[model samples]
Target: MILKLISRSKQLVPHSPVRILSLYAVLALLLFSAVLLVGLMPADAHAARILEPKQISGAFPTLAASFNPHEQVGHDQMENMDHGHDSGLSVSTALFYTARIVYYTALLMAAGMMLWFSGIRSGSDEQRKRMQQWSLPMMRALLLASLLYVFANARSLMEGYGGGGPEWLRLFTETNTGQAWLALLILSLLGFAVIKASDTFKLIWALLLLAIESWSGHVAALQSNMNLGIVLDFIHLACAAVWSGGLMILLGLWFVDRKEAGRFAERFTTAAWISMALLIITGAAITLLLLPSLSYLFYTSWGIWLIVKIALVALVIVTGALLRARVRRGELPDGLMLKVDAGLMLVITLIVGVFTYMSPLPDNTPVRFHKMGETRHFTVNITPNEPGTNQFEVKIWLPEQLGEPSEVKLVLHSRDRQQLAPLEVPLAIFEDKSYESFPGFVRTSYHAEQMDIPFPGKWTAELQVVDKSGEKVEESIDFENY
Candidate 1:
């Protein structure tokens, strides 16, 4: 068991300062080597056409909006598929993210306490008794969090469906998220039976929970290099859970029993160091596998959040160094740094929740934009904004006030410093029943199965409509020609 690893790690020969430096030097070398490999290694060039956008404009802000903007294809849809801006967070989206953060905290804290207090022989009687007193409540919290996660995920999947219980059940039981939630619920329920079980069983139980989380993660289902992705993510989540979760419990110990906490801090912090090392390595690898290109690091919402997470993680690392120094100096030097570490960790957890919620690939995610007006709305969607075969969808909406349009058409023109004639594309009236999300607007849709984008460059799409009175309205959008 990994708990046995914790005990064994403690008995290893102590490293002198020179030896510690050497170890760090070796780790740094490996880290750079890994980063280099990721950089040189080709991304999945033949990615899905209907890509997940590397969550380009999809993150916490975008999660509030639906992924399938084509359902109603109106104002809400336009807002969601907007290229760069964030849509307001919806209530359901908020609930999903909140449930996720709660479950993350609960899982980390509960599992860390169980493993440290029961699995490790070094843990004192007081620690074991304390863990016991907290076990029931912690298990209940995990169960509750798991249930919340299940409901929130189901609600997200069922958005705009307006289906009854049967549909909801189908979505849960038939989808990947549903299966993951099922496993999580079962594991959470199993935790109750093992609350007072043997320490080895507790370790196995904790690992099973981590495995569920990893299996449910986006990495696990990666179509390219799937096995490697799943294994890396499982190990990644395990290490992160051990370090962050144990740190949370350690913080609690500091408050309730500082003397015991002081005795435990050095060993726990030392273990955290190793866990953190693996965490960084795998996290970097996962990032490389998921991100479409290096440019995405600056251009996308997911990338931005990742930068924020990494920055905060650096602060946590600094706090860890401070803690290690304090432990070695025979004084905590006040718990100010500890509080700082906990606060940073909590924020990082929330951001991590965003990462878990969004898609990692550039497949279905699109470069979508729209022009809205008092009378009409024009929208365009280009899939996987890359030079190659792509899918294009154009939607035009006219309010009832405008009456029946005599003529409505869309035109395309290349914008690369060259004189080119405009090409007109036919549009057809589209009707959809799901009007609850975006109502009052009648929409017409045009779809192209495969548009061979000749090159990666700028192009302009123009929309022109003629009202009953023969008055013409025009609008154009310039895009990277996705």
Candidate 2:
């Protein structure tokens, strides 16, 4: 069976160097595809314990500073509780990295395909023969390297999926490994030999690694349906590789084959336009799905970075158009045109790099509460329901005369509020009133001026409340102390 396959491969139609170049072209595409797959499949879980309170607050100080407009001050301060925005930000960041790889890889691959097809269509038989001769070795080397790179990165890709490990490590350890390094080395050497020998069958064999690596990411059964994300990620990645790989080829041809520059540029222009359209359409779709809310887009650092990246993309498009027009008018020399195009390509690469760290917006909006105002007093009324577990009734009395409490919290005493800890109070809320359970103590939910204090020693409770300005306010219990 293998012998038959080898015979068939060697007999591929037109058996020219152009056909052989397809092998390298495909390999380049697969490499970027793998990158996209790894990148878009969701980043490995990194949310372990947040750093110190200061660090948590500092990581996004800009967003933090703007919290007043978007959040409740004094209540639900940024110092506590992991915000859902973090998750959204993470999603966006991961996709940004993936998108970057996709864009560049797609550009290179698309350029290559464009140049190859165009050259073949217009060049003479001798020119075609020269291309074939040169392409054989070059394609072989690229194919070999691509195979190794893919396999080498496989383990890191697999690690993204939950595997057996220490509980903490499972959530935080990010692996960038591919597969067994030694195995990759051996395969790379062997593939190199096969390509050098023009063993066409081995090319297909090399492609198998890419297929396997991509498939491994789709084996999940969780609420996130990570499997679906993995699949979409792969599709997105494959498209990117084709686009980038082709671009690389086109660029190389435009520079090296100056005599045939016109044909090469024309071919690349068409491919670039098509690739750009696909890039914009797919990117928009992904953005819409990932960034559902405009608020998330504006309130997070990820959103801001994304805006920056999109602006760069706009510049790239404009520059690309200018270069194409110059080439058509024959106003600019091939050398200068190539340099300008290359510069534009670099700008595109830079945009992708910036995208690597931003996060995506969330699909749903989280519930938010208002902060206590000057008229309001931070209050917590706990009523005993059982011997051990108490129904916790927590509320910030909005002074009917003034407005709302200065702050609201859940704690034994107001003094305990600054302790920056969650109060393990058995608590429940009933409408406007709160209920709590205290051992050997009892109290009603609504008692004239907030009843339901059992234990002495100035017990306090801490609660997060938002101010009118939407800034989080950290109000504590005053109790016997301040």
Candidate 3:
């Protein structure tokens, strides 16, 4: 079956079998990972533990049927569903996954552009003009898109709430009324039309949009640390797009028009150098912010994936440098360079596919909790730490006159406010009670015991504190780690 699939891939792709196989390999990995994550999910507290697969299948048949026994779909589901909630995987994972997929797609588009550019021109002035005539509209469309982005971003900046959400709209806009939104839409169309007329204006408009994006990010940062995450996310996106998108354009011109290969190669080489530098710098900065320690890099799934991405990027640079040297020495034939460039770009895309499967470091952090009990009810707070490592502290408070110690039970399970459950994770803690000489009550705190969780996802920690007489209090906290 695999061989047949490979054979079909070779027939479908215009490039080499190796290239087609590489793409399929990446797709397989992504599908496998996603299935693994979903299939292995743990059940909520209300669920009964049945040895029968039928019990499991009856509830999640759509998910179960997607995997074979060896896929460990059930195992991962049990592990994730039974374990505690993850704080890291929520937002950071979302950002990393989204960014990597988009960047990879952009890289593939670059490869396509290269092939198109190289295959199109036959050194005739008439043919070159004709190609340009056809391509001009595409350029105009891209410019128009950029302009639209600019206007939309500008409105977001001016209104403070931006198109991203209602919160951003409320933050920037003096009035969150329908008329303002309508006006912004009209302005965006006007901006797009204006920018598409010329390259110079398009460039200007793109820059303006960039400025607006930056400003909006800055404003977002002030509201919460999540804003900083938002800023970094945008920067990562812009950098990825510039490098990948620009490369796609350059490759297109070189491969499609053999006559213009030399000039296009030279121009692309220069741009590639700049893009490589930016990619490296921003990538490093992102790493520092998320993977602050070697513990994170070596221990966490997100860290491991990031390491893989860095290695791939290095491979890309080396390949690009080699190609640049070949072009300089006139050793690479025009047609061959096109194929080689496309192949290498494909490698980048594949690496990005893996990256998308991994969680982002900034978003995946361990959670800590502090508990306060009132006469009427008990309250619990779950505080998330910096991304990468899983370590959280728990604190408990009891009234002095209760005379009996409360049996505090903490359960780390996988579930959310959406559909939650309790898991049988028997966490044991040994602590001694000492009087602090406070006026009335004693405060009991538990030092954080580090849980070495490798992957990024959602987890919930439930606390069940009972007195010696069996009077009990219950609370739960949710966390996500990427």
Candidate 4:
């Protein structure tokens, strides 16, 4: 019905200059609106709450007290010790993920045009003109998407780093993500400059742009085999772009002229098979590198999201198979089925964006242990025993006093086999003595003041309890960081 309308409209106004100009103006206005929407989006909620040096120093009293009389650990050190323990699904995170989805979809559309235009021989003059007309709007959308993508990256950085001043500039100049964004911007410009050159050149440029995506993802920092992982990531992204993007272009063709698109559908089907195979291989390689065990698939949020993506991909495959069967039987593929497949692919792409910010497995698990000493029994509980900042708590039970001890102190030693100064955390006695501190009305025990673990790796926690006689009893326990 839409194609019939298009045909009728073209016949009615075949050479109406006013109508063509008005259509182009409307498209330009829409593109401008999209750019404005991204630019005017609100900043993240937490961006305003970034603590200054004084604020950080005041937050952790124990850490500030440890400063030497002549020298103090500066703001940088304190800031490093502070971790963003807030939930991952923030408004800013959601916006960035949405931006990513938009960017990837635009990329596929642009690249898919190249793939489609390159695979088939030139059709009649009318078909060629139609393809060119479609390409112009697609290219414009791609450029707009690239701009939005860069804006999203910058916005995320600004929110994460607190302000859009020197800190944000430093990140842009120093980080891999910044470098990749810069590279993408350059590529986008290059693509625009040579868009009217040749189909081969456009195809090469699109693939290169897609490959650059690897640099900004987890593949760039893979610990086991960084180089191979990045290469595989590039392959995965390229194949995905071709498969998803190609389908989008084919759908556009179906809308424009179903018969012409069907002529090349068989060839695209063959390429799609190869693309799917490569996607599975490369995606599996990257997934194995990330997930420690199969248990994570059901246990971790990242793993569950990954499973959803896998199921969506499977659905796409099934839909593609059904479409191929229809095509083979000389029947036009159902547009609704194709739409469902495209929608699934879109969701899968968005999930990939979300995965970029989420961890593949759980990182924080509290460590608990008990130690029997000569004069004191210590029950230690370390909350969120992760590699970053952590809270350390100890409850000392004095068998003789039948009341709270006068003093409690904690010293941390890095068990890295290198000689280092001990980090002392003075524990203040909780005056309120809540039920958690004295669960049984036996006032012999009091909760020690909590302290933060500023760093990770193997560490030993030495607890010292001073009795009324000024005698100190010490107990040490060793543990590894997450």
For this target, which candidate reaches the highest lDDT against the unseen true structure? 1
lDDT tens per residue, model 1, 378-429 = 7777776565556667676777666557776766677764576765655555
lDDT of 4: 0.62
Lowest lDDT block of 10, candidate 4: 42-51
| Model 3, span 1-482: residue lDDT tens | 01112135443113345754575467446434533432343422111111123434464432322311212212233333322233666773354444444434532232222223322223334433533444444444434443443344334233322235643444334422222333433433444353334333433443344333333321222212223333544444445545554455555556566445555555456446655665565455444433323455775665676677677677667767876887788654345545565565556655555554444434423354444445423333333432223344445555667633466666666543324344433334447365433344544544444533323346666777776567777777777653
Q: By TM-score, how accurate is candidate 4?
A: 0.64
| TM-score: the better of candidates 1 and 2 | 1
> In candidate 3, residue 37 scores what lDDT?
38
Q: Go through the candidates in order and give each one's C-alpha lDDT.
A: 0.66, 0.41, 0.44, 0.62
Best by TM-score: 1
The lDDT ranking, best first, is 1, 4, 3, 2
List where candidate 2 sits over 4 angstroms from the true fold: 1-235, 326-334, 362-376, 379-482
TM-scores for all candidates? 0.66, 0.44, 0.41, 0.64
Off by over 4 Å in 4: 1-93, 121-130, 160-166, 365-377, 382-395, 401-482
369-463 per-residue lDDT for model 4 (tens digits): 78655555677777767543456667776655445666777778888644878988665545535564333323343343345564445688887
Query: Where is model 1 more than 4 Å wrong at Cα?
Result: 5-40, 45-87, 117-123, 360-449, 452-478
> Where does candidate 3 stray beyond 4 Å?
1-196, 209-242, 298-302, 331-337, 343-359, 362-482
For model 3, the local distance difference test gives 0.44
Q: How close is candidate 2 to the true structure, as a TM-score?
A: 0.44
Error of 1 at 89 (Å): 2.9
